[model samples]
Each structure stands twice: as C-alpha cells, then as structure tokens.
Target chain A: MPTTDADTTFRFLGCSEIQEILGKQAVDERQLAELLEEVPLDSVYYHTHSYFLRSRFIERTYPNDFAQWVAQQLQDHVLAERLSVVDPFDFQSLEALREELISLIDDHLSGMRTVPRATFGTPFYFNRSRILEVPTGIEVQTLREFRDAISDVDSSAIYFHVFEAHLRLQREENDFSAWFRGSLKLPDLADRMKALNPYLGSLERLRSNMLTMCDEQLAKSGRG
Target chain B: MIRELEQYREVAPKGTIDFLYRLSDLVQDKRFLHISAVRYGGGMVEILRRIVPIMKAMGIEARWEVIAGTQEFTDVTRRITDGLQGREETITNEMYQTYLDVNARNAKVLNLDADLVFVHDPQPAALVDHRKGGKWVWRCHLDAGLPHRPVWSLFRRHVLKYDAAVFSLPGFAQRLPIPKFLLYPSIDPLTEKNRELSRAEITQVLDQFGIARGKPILLQVASFDRFKDQIGTIRAYRMAKKHHHCQLVLAGSGVAHDPEGEAVLAEVQQAAENDPDIHILQLPPEADREINALQRGATIVVQKALKEGFGVSVSEAMWKGKPVIGGTAGGVSTQIVDEATGFIVHSVEGAAFRIRYLLSNPSVMSRMGAMAKEHVRRNFLITRHLSDYFTILKILSSE
Candidate 1:
C-alpha cells in the first residue's frame, strides 16, 4: 500500500494530552546549569522517546541492544510493506488529507475511546459564574417568521449536511475510534466562521438556533 | 533630549523600553511565572527572551520555565495542539495517558507559588493541578472557537480551573465561567530581527538566499510546519505570479518538538516545482535578525496557516510596515483587517487575487502597509501586553 493524503493532517496540542503520556524527567537547577555549561551555545538538549520516532531513529537510542531486537524481528517485519499517505510535497493532496482528517475527527466520539478519567476544572481560576446565557428562540408560532429569520441561515443548512456527515462517521463503533468523536472541529471552525462576521450577526443566529434545535430535540426525546 | 523616543512613534518618549521602569513599579511586589514545553523554540520563546530581561531590568520578579517531560510528553502535546486547532488526531488511550503522566510529573516540580502563574498555551495547562499560592491564567494563543471535542474536553478540564483566561483576540477567547482578557502578543522592536538593517546586509542576505527582490516578492515568514500551510502559500504565489510576476520566499525554522517540519518543508518544495523564485528556506532557529530582514525586504507578507494561533508573523510584518494578506483562519483574520490592513483569504485563489490586487497598485499597498503598522502599534505591543498582565495580577491579588 502506498501512502495517501488522508494520513497527515494536524491535530492540536493541549495540556491534558501532555499530562497523560509524556514520560517524567527530573530537572534540577544544578543539572540544567551543568548541561548549560557542557552544551554548546544556541543548542538546547532535547530527549525524545523511541515510540514517537518515525521508527528509523529507534536504533540511535538503544544502540547495541536494539540491533539484536531488529535482527530478531526482521524475519517477521516486512519493511517493503510500509505505506505513507501524508506526503509533505503535495499541496492539493495535503488539503485532501486535511479534509479526510477533518471528516475523521468530526466522526469521533468520546464514548468509543477507553480514555481514563482525569481531574476536571480549568487550570486557572474557576469560571463558575455565568456569563450571558441567552436561550435562543426558534420555536416561533408561524413559518413566515421562521422563514424570515432562517433566510439568513439557509446557506448554513449546507454546512449542516457536512457537519452531520462528520458526526455520523464518528458515531460508528467498529470504525477508527479516534475519528468517531462528535463535531470535534467546532472550535477552529468557529474561528473561521468569525471571519464571516462581515455578513453581520446572521451566523451567530444560526449557531444559536442550531444549538436550540439540538436542545429542543433532546427535550422532546427527554434526553436533556 | 527625547531623541531615542523620536525613533519610535509607537511608544512614549525614550521608547517603551523605559516603560519597563513603570512596569517594574507596578509589579514591584509580584512574582510572575510562565510554563511551556520548550524554552528555546517558536514565538513563545521569542517573546519570553526579550520580555524577561526587560522585566528584570524593571526590578520585577519574573521567571520562565519549561515543563519537564519525555519524548512522549512532547508527542502528546503536539497531538493536542493539532486537536485544538481542529486537526483530526487518532488519539488513542495511550495518547491520553502520555498527556496525563507528563502533566503530573511537571506539576510536582513547578512552583505554582507565584502571585501569578501565566500558563502559556495547552502544553503545560494542567500544571494548575499543583495548588500553590498564585492564581493561574491560561494564555491561549490558539483559536479555541472550534476545538476537537475530546482534545478540547481534555483542555477545558484545565481551562475551567483558571482565575481568568487570556487570548490574542475575542473570537479566540472561549465562553467560559472565567472572564477572558484580550492581549495582542508583540515582537520586540529592539530585537536583532526588528532592528534597523543596512541595505547592504539585507542585500547580502537576499543574494545568499538567491532571492532577487527587485521583482515583486510575496512571502510568508513562519516555521515550516504543516499548519502554516506552506504549500498553499506556494500555490497562491504561483497564481499571483502568473499575472504579477512576483516571487515567494517561504522562510522559517523547524521547532524542537515539531516532528513534521521536514515533511512539510519538502511538500512546500514540491509545490514550488523547482521555481527559482520560490525560496523555501530552513534557517537557523535563533536567526531572528534574518527573519526581520526577510520581512523588511519583502513587498508583501502572508501567513497561510490552515489554522493559526495569534500569528506573530502578521504583527511582525505589519510592524515592518509591509502590506499583508493572511489566512482566514484563527488569529490571522483578526490581524488583517481585510481590504484595509490587508486581505484575509480562505483559499489559494483568494490569496492570489489579493496578492495581485496589492501588486497592481503600489500606492494602495503602501497605504495598507502604513495602516497595518499603525494597527499593530496600537493593538500589539509589549506595553499593551504588560498592562494586561498588570491588571490581571491586580485582580487576582484582590481576590
């Protein structure tokens, strides 16, 4: 299998992810001071784990011990079978890769992944107090008012389709567990949508209406 | 008498460099600590490097620290960075574990005891777990309006713990219980990169890079990270060059932990198709002066990050009085006022059209460049940033 564009879109880095997986290293001031002395100017000493490497760098860390493991594993390992989809050299393919990734993330859900429970709450002060929590009204009595209000959001209805396809893809249990997470691209999209602010406050209305519709559906289904 | 200040109309007399005295007076009794994954890489380091010395000169107690963790720690944080910017990560259970373990180890060591602990980005966000005397402020440089849910869920766990959150723009600031303050991050004008460059030095560097700049240049100064979308930048440059005959210099350095910089740089090279005009540079990381000269020499600057944090390059270019066309994603859109400071585009064609538009009219471009610089001076500066910090510390201390 050859590498394709679908494999290499970016995933954002955050603190919680760092908390869970990064190995611990004790950094005493003395050790840092010592390394600063030994290390040449303008270069910082970086230590990386073997698993994170692209597999070839693995030998450098374990040296003699790793050569023996490679010799033992080479019988089963088919180096020729390796595939790559995330080529950095291809531009359209990169966008296509990003699209495929966005679709994958859109579909991912939290329930599918067996992640451990961690402590909750912001790392700074508690934002427990409520800001303006306005309940957007979408359950108006007549279609005329709905049409007038929704005329601004008719284009968003198209995005609603993309958003739904993304959600449905992530909802599948047997599929890639990471891709099944729900509407996960909302935060960055919300920013991209901010650039659409020249269209007035219409998008905000649509977003609020969509949230309201979801709440309404949940209430009708008695899920909320 | 006020000769030094006259050089910079952006700051008060004697330059905002002297404002360090006033800032020191304000923060005389305060302790400020910052936590990140690496101390030497990226825009965060650039800002910290200049500000720390100035803060010390002001007689303020300020320290910068990187969270101690292994390769897995960096990998997980990288994934989370991707996730938060709305990148799809096949985040596994093991990945989550990497994130937690790293944070736990860092928490045990970081002295969460300052009057204000300024948490820089999602890397060490969870160090809030270490309860000390100081209040924590998560300075989110990325756009959080659309975050990958599980990733955001992981981060929001830490975000919900802050005294207050600080963002580069209001659109990036999330709607949470804690109030969000907007502080535009700035580049040091006195830094080697932003300082005056002799025409000979600029010409020498350009000649060395094989960048013939008498022709119109459309450039994007950023790290060779995939998120910076260097390929898309090339495509736009090609399109614009078809009509405008402009060259593009995609200049940047690789970060310490970004595993994909080389791969992204290669893609950018391929996208250029061996065009002599398209210069894909992998400069030294500390080559800030070179970056400044690159921007100062350029005709137009672009930051085509498919998703961006507060793009420091956009501010840097605007500060250099260069017209810019930025991506319509994250903080780029906020910086480029679109048709005023510069055009904000969503696609290659859009960027191309804007590039052509700017090239077609030099007077318009000049006006836009001037406006862009004023926009940066008024909004993005160390003085403005420090003031935001001063107010936040006062509020936190009161509480």
Candidate 2:
C-alpha cells in the first residue's frame, strides 16, 4: 500500500508465511526428515497445496528424492493444464494473454458460451467466411432506450459500453463501403485497443478497410 | 521526472549508455504498451507512471493502459491471483466465466495495438485477446514459480499464445513455445524512497510519528498481509529483547484487492498487545514520506516477508544506507547480500542474530549500512531497470 511510485515496486512476502509453507523451522536434517515422514507422502494436493512445499519450502527439507517427487508432480499435473497454473513464468507475457483473450470473443460469437477450458486451450476459432450476424435498427434504437433507462449509480457502464461499441461496429457492417470510406477512431473505445489492434477477422481485410478509409479521409482534404 | 532520471547519474558509470544509442540505431519504431489492473496502484502502475513518459522521451512510442473492469472483474481476478500465488481457493464455474466474461468485455474495448505489449501481473492478462498486431509479452510480477493449478490453468489458456514472457527471476519462469526474459524489479532511487532526505526532514517525520530516534527502532514498511510476516517481525523483536531494548514498527497500508490485509492487521495487533514498543500502523496508500521517515528514523530496517516477489522496501532502505535484515525468501535475497549488504536470514533467530549484531556494533551497523546502499545503487535503481526493459524491447524488436 505504500505509494509514491517507487515504494510499490517490489512484491513483498514475509517470513512467517514461508515458515508456514515449509513448516516451522525444520529443526535439522534429522528433524526435517522426521517431519517429512509424518507428512504422509502419498497424499494428493492441488497445485497451490503442492507448491507450498515445492516452491518456497524445498530448501527447508532435504532437497533430494522427496523434492524430486514434488517437482515432477508440479511439472506434470499443475503446469500442463490448458488453463494457466503457477504465477506467470517467462512465457507468460501480456502480449500472449491479449491474443488469447481475443479468441474468447470469437468463441462467444460462436455457439460456445462456456468458460475457457483450462485443458482445452483457446475455445474460439475465427474464419473470414464466418461473419457475425448484426442486430438490426430496432435493437440499436432499442439499446439507446435501454441506455436511457438506467441510473448512474448502478454498475452498467461496461454493459452499456459493450452494447454501444457493438452497435457502432454492427452499424459499420450495414454500410460497409461507406463505413470503410469513413475514419473509425472508436473514441468511446478505450485507447488500449487502438494499441492492441486485435485479430478481428483477417489482417488483409482490416488493411483494405484502413486503406479505403484513408483514401476517403484524404478526399475530404482534397488529397485523395 | 527528468530530474529523477538525473539522479541515476549519481551512481552509474560514466558514458555507459552507448548501448542504448547503439540499440536505437538498430531499432525500428515499435510501440511500447503496458497493461495491468488498477492503473493508479501496485508495482506495475508505479513503474509505468515514471517509465512510460521517459520511454516517450527516449523516442519509443510508449503508453500505459489499465484493462478496464468492474468490481466483479477485480474480485474474481484477485481470487485468481491468490490461487495462482499458491493460495488454496475454490475456483467455481461462475468465477471462471466471470473472469472470461470480464476479459471479453475488455477485449471489446482495450486498445492493445502496440508492437510490444507488456502485461503486468495476472489481472488484465487476458487483455491480450484484444491484441491486434503486436508481439505480446506477459510481464509477470507475482511469484508464479509455483501456483495453484485451477487458476493457472485458467490463465494458461491465454498464456501460451504470447510471443514471449518476462519474469522477475529465472526460477519464476514457465516453459513455453515463446522465449522469456529474467528481469529484477527496481526502485527509483531519487524518489522519496531513495532520494536524499535532509536530516531535519527525517527528524520532522520521526517527531510527527513520535518514533524516538534516541531509542533503537526496527521498522518494516510493507502491506498489512500475512505474506509480509508482520507477526513474525514482532516475535523476533521480542526474542531479541532478551539482550537489548528496541521498538518494532510494523508500518503498512491496506491494499484494496487484498481481502486478507485487515485480518492480518488484526492478528498482528493481537500479537503486539502487551508490547508498547510495537507500533502496528496501517497508513494510507500514498504513505511514502511517512515510510521514508520511518526507515530514515530506524536503526535497523527489517523486511520480514515470508514470501516476496521482491522487497523494494529493503532496496529503499538500502538506498537510504540502512542495514536491512530480511528473510531469504523470494527476491529479498536478490537485494540482501548476506552479511555483506545486511543479512539474508531465515528465521526470527537469524533476524534476531543480525538485528542484535547491528544494535551491538555501531561500526558493523554503519559499515553494513554503507554496503547495503552501494548494493542498491549498483543493482536496484530505476535506471538499471530501464536498461533491463530496453534489453527486452531490443531483443523483441530485433526478432
């Protein structure tokens, strides 16, 4: 909670927690060994309970055969999940997370309404032939009605924005050529998107769309 | 902030930034992006606040963005973080859908069209779904070396799609098709943390807090969470009391996402009950000046965390030239050089051993204090971190 940009820099985990994970001062080699014997080696725990001993507490007990078992179990059982496990490792970059997140949209547009399968990898698949059906004007003007029907205090900003952005996107589909001729800043959209530029359908289609929009904008400025 | 950048010149070698100039010669223009939860709080936001503008100054197209989410989004993400950080929590179907549902909403809106997107920590990590034409990298700040399977599994669905990943340590990285980089998180030495405070300023803070500099002060500036080991610090101080008289100051503030903070603070207060010397303070979030005063006023600075992504507070103390006694956990060892900077210890006994050593030998205390400062000056400065980040950018840009 300490602020001023610098203080919040490093993550802090204190000693007693480590002790709790490793168990109270292993006493010694003999004592740690005895404690390990009492821990019922055959017991099964999920990734967190399993890692309690593997990640931080490995040094406390003998870093030998038993440690190897714990390490193996962690790699095979926990890390291999289709869903993420463990704190993000090096391969766990933000860019990758963003790509995977975009896939969820395709999945949502598809028949799949399920949560992302931790074992199934990405649930969404995109193809150029698969154009999402756009909701018509009654829905659009209807959404404006819905937007007006709400109170400010309630948590509907995301819902409202989703509907608005979707309607804006769908409206572009209705007048595809004209929309392509026009610039689309999507201002109500957060700026991060102007940055991420997700795999909406196909890269070539988007590029053509951008080129056409550029030409149209240039025509207004007498530079087409 | 330029003045803040200038302070790094105080310690860095002369004419050392030639690599940057050389790298710029080899670099093509690439947009730099950072995404995480809560743009105003936490380590990543703090880093980006100072760094992004400077990145712009250096001619990189850099901007910081937070993945917008509702309270439900944050609440689920917090649980995922706890689960991924190895806490045993039940991740139900509702929680999982909530996470995806939230990410989908963000994907629909977040502008992620950078050449290189750096996602900080678990939350908003799914924003990569919105990724357009960028080589995304997940810059994981938490201790994911070992995480709960259910949550990680949930996250991994998106993790493998990245171009690469970056971790705080080699030990904390996961194997994937994409490459990963190991970078240590660092502090801006010129900030209120490492910035040179006038004696009067330090004394004024000390007087304000009623922390007598005349008496020995053992201070820890961290969050009020169990992971920080505030309870254990009190116990060590009590144990060390057999030979010396000292005060223990567990000064911290509560983070909004951490539900356990208040509970841990309660436990710490319970432990420090009879001991009047133990000051269990829960300050506001922006309590840097107070933290600086507390550390500057301290005879020994202790970062008694049980698990750590890295104890920047230790580095903060090191910047101030105070002897630090820390648990050899997480990235704490990365800072504490063990009997050199201070002591990379393991237990209350070990902490007590080093704390008692410093309290007893004024010269040892002073020497170690100097060494700690130099250690931070060498490794944990913001400039060093800037160079590390550019190295990643450099590597990615080339690829």
lDDT for position A160 in model 2 = 18
lDDT by residue for model 1 (B1-399), tens:
233222344442122333323334555768888777778766667778766655655556878888888887778888888788777776788987787788888788766678888889888888786657778888888877667888787778788888878776555655678756656677666667777789988888888888886898787888777778888888888788778777888888754566677677767778888888888888886788788888888999988787667777788888888988887566675666667788767778888888888899999999989877766764566554554555555556557
Quote each prediction's TM-score: 0.58, 0.61
DockQ (C-alpha) of model 1?
Answer: 0.01
Q: Candidate 1: what lDDT?
A: 0.56
Candidate 1 chain A lowest-lDDT run of ten: A13-22
Candidate 2 lDDT for residue A147: 25
Fnat (0 to 1) per candidate: 0.00, 0.00
> What's the residue-level lDDT of B321 in candidate 2?
81
Model 2 residue B280 CA deviation (Å) reads 2.4
